[model samples]
Target: MADTNAQEDFSKLTADLAVLRADVAKLADTLTTLARSQGEAAADAVSSRVRQGKAKAEATASELMDEGRAAYDEARERAGKIGGDVTAVIERNPLGAVAAALGVGFLIGLLSRGR
Candidate 1:
């Protein structure tokens, strides 16, 4: 009876070990699959963020370009207006304009010689 009981216990233990080994293998497979999916998800999130950042940067650059163009246009318009005003003044007083030009030239020459 003792021998029989021991044999039965041994068989049961062997069977239990086999089942435990299978369960451990299944757990490892599950963990591997979970890790692979998580890595892929992380990569996708990073890619999406990069795309959003790129679009935002492009939009900012476009806005800056538009602002630059507007500023240039305004500057050009103001310069045109000032040029017209100066022309009118010069036309109204040709002799005065000539005298002013000579005076300015003389002053500039004097200053440059000192330097």
Candidate 2:
């Protein structure tokens, strides 16, 4: 009777160990799957943020380019107006303009000699 009882207890212990090992393996697999999904989610979120930042930067650069073009146009218009006014003054006073030119040239020559 003692031998039969000992044999049965040994068999029961062996079966419990097998079940425990299977449970541990299943737990490990679940943890690995969960980690993989979380990593993928994080990567997707980072990519989305990068795309949004790129779009915003492009829009800002476009606005700056437009402003630069407008400033260039305004400067060119001002230069044209100033040139027209100078032409009119020269037309009104031909001899006086020539005298002024000679005076400027003489002053520049004096300044160059000093330098």
Candidate 3:
């Protein structure tokens, strides 16, 4: 009778171990699925952030380009006006313009002497 009882306990223990193994397998599957889902979510979030950053950079670049164009246009207009004024002055006093040019040339020569 004692041997029979020991045999029964051993059987029960084996069955319990099998059940625990199955439960562990199920848990592992659940954990793997959860990890995969979380990874996907993280990747998606990163991709979204990258897209947003790209858009922002593009927008900033576009704005800078527009500003550069505006600055170029303004500078061109100012240069044209200054050129017209200089032309008027040179026409009004030709000898004075020549004298000024000679003086500027002399100054430039002195400054560039070391080079």
Q: In what order do the candidates fall by lDDT, top score first? A: 3, 1, 2
User: Which candidate, 1 or 2, has the higher TM-score?
Assistant: 1
Task: Tell me the tens digit of each residue's lDDT in model 1 across 8-100.
Answer: 999999999999999999999999999999999999999999999999999999999999999999999999999999999999999999999
Whole-model Cα lDDT of every candidate shown, in order: 0.98, 0.96, 0.99
lDDT of 3 by residue, 20-65 (tens): 9999999999999999999999999999999999999999999999
Cα lDDT over the full model 2: 0.96
Clashing pairs in 1: none
Looking at model 3, residue 14 earns an lDDT score of: 95
| Model 3 global lDDT (CA atoms, 0 to 1) | 0.99
Error of 2 at 27 (Å): 1.7
- Candidate order (TM-score): 3, 1, 2
Give the per-residue lDDT digits (tens) of candidate 2, residues 3-69: 9999999899899999999999999999999999999999999999999999999999999999999
Instruction: Candidate 3: give the clashing pairs.
Output: none
C-alpha lDDT (0 to 100) for residue 59 of candidate 1: 100
